[model samples]
Target: MIDLIALRRRLHRHPELALHLPETRETLLEAISSLGLRVETSTSSSSLAVVVPGAGPGPTVLLRADMDGLPVTEESGVGFSSSNGNMHACGHDLHMAALVGAVHELTRRREEFEGDVLAIFQPGEEGAGGAELMIAEKVLLTTGRKPLASFGVHVLSFAEAGMFYCREGAVMGATINFELKVLGRGGHAARPHTALDPISTAALIVQGIQTFVAQNSSPADPIVITVGSLRAGTAANVIPNTALLKVSLRATSSQTARDAYRKIAGLGAAIAEAYGLRMTSEVGPDLGPTVSDKEGVELVRQTVGDLYGAGRYKELTVPEMISEDFSLFLEETGGAFVLVGAAVDGTPHQLPTNHSSEARFDDSVVPEIANLLAELAIRRLNIASETNRWA
Candidate 1:
């Protein structure tokens, strides 16, 4: 059995920021090497892929865990507090520990498996699209081997520990971030009639965007448009020339995401025109939705059923509006992304949400996660072999 507490403590002490997870990467690589697995760096600092070569030729299975920490202060009160301002608010520390535990188990039982297993320790999953960067560096093609399928799991604080959740289609929402800048003539506060205030234009844009979401999106289809930040005048006696608005758009489907983006841009322009201000809207790349493969989902569900019985696993009726960069990996290899429960009794009555400073992960579920991942890899490899034998 793997010492999950030690692994989590190590990750907690060495919190790595996005694209700069050298310390965490080195730690994970060292652990993989200790397990007798050959480790390969992604040529970039964003990812590390380890391979445990099997005895025979079979389908290669890939298991992924995100390694980057969030830019939040530590408030969990654990003895292993992060020295830096960053914290593992998203339970990435638990993710790394669970994967390491799985690796340890797989290495011990390596003879039972036929094909090689790839363990992906990825960074920048918070928002920087580290998975995409890893793919660009050919992280998937480790040791010149391509994965037949991949699997990833995230710990959900809302559910009770030892339970697992997954769904067939659209498991997570697509996200698009944008910034709107409204430029106008600046003047003294007393001379409001002479100068155009961009703040007014920005306010109109925010209201218009909210109305657009209500009017355009279908009731059955979930969509969220939030203006997280707004900045305008610096001084009370001056009307600032520029106003900046930072917005995030989320939808279960790509079409919904596209529609929301179009509407937001149109509304910004219209609001600016009505307020006599010049509006410049910048849209960032879309972090597409997490669409789980049907077969892969069934495989994960069956594995969970075998471990926890059929009634214990629940299929989510609706996709979560929260975003994850792991969707990028699923998009590439056509795999499944699961949400593992991490709720614990006697702790905080209400578990803090991800990215919150007070967010605490239930370490008790680490072993369950390790078992699920190892079983998923074994099952996928066996299924592939059976299919090939029939062919």
Candidate 2:
């Protein structure tokens, strides 16, 4: 048996960030080195891909785990709290351990299965699009194995511990990052007519966004427009020449997400025109909603039910507002993304969420996640044939 708790604590103590996760990669490599498998390291980024061959011929399956930490300081008060400024606020550390455990268990039972397993340890999942990068690097088809399907696991901080959650379509929302900059004349605070104030225009734009969502979007169609950061003048005595606003948009579908983006752009233009100021803005890359395949999701649902009774697996009634880069991988290779609950000591619905400094992940769920991932791979292999492969 793998020592999952000990390995999780070790990773939790020393968290790394983004694609340059050398320490985290090294730790994972060490944990799985003992297993008799072909392991290869990525030259472009801090990533590892392992291949485990079975006894007979079958389709190949991929299992993924992200290995990046956030910039927040540790405040969960765990015994293995990170002393470094970075922390695993989103439970990536648990993800790493669970993937490793799955590899160990699967390798031991290699003769029992009939296909190959491709386990990928990815980096920079928080916002860096690491999944797409790995896909481009041929992480999915590196061993010349025909791709059958894919599977991934994420630990949630707010749901009930040991419970699994997933849906057949739109499990998570699409996201776009936008920046709006308003330029105007700067002058002394005492002067009124001499200077066009951008701060005032920005405030109006923010308020207008709320009304736009309410008026334009339907109640059944959910859209969220949040202005998370605002920057303006350096001093209180003088008005700044330019104001910067960073906004985030989330929607349930691609068309809805595009409509929300266009709405924000229109609001910025209208606000700037009203104040006789110039506006410049840019929309960053958009992550599409993670839509799961009906067959793949049903397979996962059955596997979870077998692992931990039918009551332990929940089919989400509505999509989540947050976005994940795993959507990129699932889009390229058809699969399902399962969320394993790791609620802390408090009420499941009222606990702190992922990315919160106070959020705590239940370590006991590590093995459960491992079992689910391994079973999903085995079950998918049994259903697929070696001739039917994905490019």
Candidate 3:
């Protein structure tokens, strides 16, 4: 009896961002307040860990939904579009609503399943490492037992509506953020010989990144590097004392990610040292490249095939460049991240991508999404316990 469309539209109208989503958290808490499920909130973040105990105790299963909005202005022009300056332009509003529906479905079928469901509403999924923050608080073991496996689904506004896509391992790319600062003596632009030009040194570092990757990495391996931000020099004629450059790297494997980072950092230092300047580099934690467990993925395939037809489940031959903190969850428990298509209106394979101001999703698939999530949890519990996953 839950009106998922209405709920999603309501959330879509008012979007919040990052770990400190008080309004979004309150809205979610109130929506499920009358459900009588056991709920717990995080001390470090505005995350919710809800448990729906079954008729009998066996094992626990983890299901997650991200709960943050991007910093995009509303332009999708939906009737319930957000006007709060923050937008769920990434389809997280649908994700939250679908998970809520899943909780409701699992509660109604509590007697049919014999294990607990741990529903995680995570914040700061955009880039703030909220998943890592929540996991630090030990919410993963909230059922007093390790979950057999975990599963999460994403709504892709650009993909075909109602279809599910997945891959067995490393379905998404692992990401690393590298920032380099070149320190040198500042001087007028006309006096280039008098000053160690950090700007030129930074440019050399960027060029070296491309050449190093091309020389070292295989073409088939898939490595991506983007210069996110570069800032140097204040005035037109004056050279700044330091030049700062931020680079983002994404790769399919951990070894490749590490190799790329090391080279980039080393390249900056090597170029600076040659220019008689010192370069400082900051390397962030290599966050993702969400790996799907073989068994976990099969569970999704079977569940999706049974719920929908076999044609609904699309296998991914190649991994995606997109990264998610959901990888942090998969690190603790085996899981697969599945993408559900939710295009509002578009031809097949052509639609606006998520994170854009024009992104739109079909909330009518909310029921189907809730059912898939509920089934994954139930099936994981049944199979893991039968195979002695904990023992």
Candidate 4:
């Protein structure tokens, strides 16, 4: 068996970012090569799919783990912190290690089950649309046997470590990236009336944008619009020609997401027009929402409960506002993306959350997720076989 803790630490030390993770790819390739699974690298992106066959023919199941790191510099204070100015603040390193552990456990017990397990190591999930590219390249269909179900696990920073938390529908919200350029006439700062200040216009738009979700959308449906970045004049003396705003929109449903985007864009345009400036707004690709199918959720709930006892599993009453690209898998093949809590030392308040430079993940949850993924695949395989037999 691979030394999971050691492997995770190694990955954590040397983090890679986005779709072009050559080093991460090589590391993952070496880890899975000895297992004798049929592995293929994606021609379009830095991703690979490995097929592990069982003792006999049955439905196929896909287990996925994203392999990408954030661009944030490490302040996590771990001995294994990355020195290259990149950190796995979101715990993708742990995801990779846990999936590898699952591969180790499932391949050893292949004789106990009868199906193929396609383990997908995906990169560029942070914002590069890795899932969409893989889908276009047919990552799901490459296993030869059509996958009856798919399963994926993500680590959350605040939830209790070694526990699983998720909801059945819309567990994660959809993400939309928007850039707004507020253009205005540049003039001397001394002549206040002469300058059409875009910086002032952008400030107003930023403060007013949040009201779109609160006033326009229903309270029952959740939406979040955040202005992550704002930049204007470099010097205090001159009014800049343009101001820029980079914002993110997350919503539980597509309609809510779209509606929020429209309202915000319209508001920005109006603000610019009133200031005698031109505002151009463009929205990026939608990172689809991760929603769990009913059957898949029940299967996971039962499997985790059985393995770690009922207390280890809990479903959230409301979906989380954060977004995930795993939504593509659920949209295509109908599956569940389970959220396993990995708060550092099981105390969320003490440590930073995911995407934080100081964010730290508990390694103890690594094997727990591994066990959950393995058991989920086995149980789903049996359930698929029984359903096929009846049909």
Candidate 5:
């Protein structure tokens, strides 16, 4: 068996970002070189898929793990921390290692199942839409047939160790990236009345949007809007011609996200018009929220309860504000995204969350993750064979 801890730490030491993860891919390839399973590579991104054949002919089931790191610098104080200025603050190291471990587990019991186990290692999940790229590159058809169902596991840095959390529908929120620009006249700072300052217009637009969103937001229908970047002028003495504010909107559904974006555009235009300046907003790729099928979530719940006892299973009542491209997999082939808790030893409230510079994950949960995923694949394949479930 591969030393999962050493492999994960090595991956952590050489963290790579976005789609072209050459170093990360090489390490992962070395980890699986001795497994002797059928492998396939992607041309669009640094994504790969491995297939383990079962006893009888049956549909394929996919197990996925994201393979990208974040842009944040590490501050977790671990001995094996990354020094390449990029860190796996989101626990992609753990995800990759656990998936590798699960692949090993399934390989040992290949004859006990009825279908092929397709393990997908995907890169560029942070913001590059690696899932979409893989789908476009025909990575989903690696097993000679489109996957009947796909399953993925995500490790949370702040969640309790050894617990599995999931929800039925809309488990993750949608993303809308917008840039609100106000066109104004540039003039000398000394003459305030002659220049239509966009900085003032931008300030007004930000305040107006925040005020409106706050008044409209509620517990049941929450909308989150954050102005991540704002740029206006190069020098203090001269007023710039334009002011741009890069904003991100998060909501439970696509309709809500589009509605909020429209409202924000309207607010920006209104504020700019009031200031006698033109305003325009452009929206980026709107990746819809992730929704898990009812049957898939139920199967995961049963598998977790039976394997790790019922106490290890926790049902999430609400959707998270974050978003991922994994929504594409669930949409292509119905499946559930399960969360495995691997927080370091600390109070839940005190531990740092994912994407934080101080975030630390417990590598001890790698074996547990492996066991649960292996059991899920076997049982799901058996159920599909018996019932001929083509979903």
Candidate 6:
């Protein structure tokens, strides 16, 4: 059995940010080398791939783990708390440890597996689109190996430890960030008739947005529109010339997401016009939904059945409203992303969710996660080899 706690500690001590995972990359490369695998670093700073070449030519399987810390500070009070304000509040440390454990276990049981396993340590998953960068560098093509399938695991605080949750399609919601600027003439606050207060207009716009969602969207189709930040006046006596509003929109389906965006944009424009203000709306890059392939999900389910027992796995019926950058990778290549249970009890440390400053995880399930990753890779490679033989 691998010492998962030790691995987790090492990663927690050296958390990496997007495009700055050199220390984390070095650590992962050293771990892979210890397992006697030939490791290849991407020319791009965002990724690294480790290949454990099999005795014979067979299918290649890719297992991915994102390596980037969030901007939040750690309050876990553990000895390995983040040195800088940046912390692994999203459980990327556990992900790296689990992937390393899987590599170690697969190397020990190399004879049981027939094909190569490529472990990808990708960076910039925290809204940076690092997966796209890695793929652009042709990490898959350069390996001279095409993956029959790919697998990834995410730690979940909502479920009990040792239980794995997965689904066939749309495991995560679509995310899009937007900003609205409301511009108007400025004057002294004492003379209300002299100035067109943009703050008042912005407030009305915000309220109008909520009403728009309620009136436009169907009750069954869930959509969330949150105005996270708003800025307007600098001083109580002066009406600012401009106001800015930053909002995030999320939806289960593409149509719903588009509808929400349209409604929000239209509402902002209408409210600004009614208040004698000019509005400019800007939309940010899209974070696509995590849609699992049917065949890939079935493969994961079967592999988990062999490792654990039948009926131990549960397929989530409703897709989670949470968003993940891993969805970008799934969009490029068919793959299955799973959520592994890591809940804990005591002072309710689990009360804090991901991105929360008080977020914590049950470290005991690290070994199980490692085992699950290895099994998924082995099974995918086996299926690929079988398909090739028939072809």
TM per prediction: 0.93, 0.94, 0.91, 0.96, 0.94, 0.90
In terms of TM-score, the best-performing candidate is: 4
* Model 5 Cα shift for residue 324 (angstroms): 1.6
Off by over 4 Å in 3: 187-194, 233-238, 347-350, 385-391
Tens-digit lDDT track of model 3 for 1-391: 8788898998889888888888888989988988899999977788999999988978898999999998899898888889889999988889899999999999988887777999999999988889988888888889998777889988888788999989899888898987899999999899889998898888888889888767876667888888878999779999889999988899998778888888788887998999899999888657868999998888889999999999999998888777888998898888899989898885845777888888889998888999999988887777766776665
Per-residue lDDT tens digits for candidate 2, residues 69-131, read 999998988888999999999999999999999999888878877878889999978777788
What overall lDDT, based on C-alpha atoms, would model 3 receive against the true structure?
A: 0.87
Residue ranges of candidate 1 with Cα displaced over 4 Å: 345-350, 389-391
Highest lDDT model number: 5
Model 4 steric clash pairs: none
Worst 10 residues of 2 by lDDT: 382-391
lDDT of each: 0.83, 0.86, 0.87, 0.87, 0.88, 0.80
lDDT (tens digit, per residue) of candidate 6 on 176-231: 88899999999988897888888999999999888876776565667878897899
Q: lDDT for model 2, please.
A: 0.86
Better of 1 and 2 by lDDT: 2
For residues 208-304, write the lDDT of model 5, one tens digit per residue: 8899788887889889888988999999999999999999899898999999899889989988998899999998768788888988899999999
Model 3 TM-score, all chains together: 0.91
Per-candidate RMSD, Å: 2.2, 2.0, 2.4, 1.6, 1.9, 2.6
Q: Predict model 5's lDDT versus the native.
A: 0.88
List where candidate 2 sits over 4 angstroms from the true fold.
385-391
- Taking the tens digit of each residue's C-alpha lDDT, what string does model 1 give over 28-69? 876666665687776567477888766677768899999999
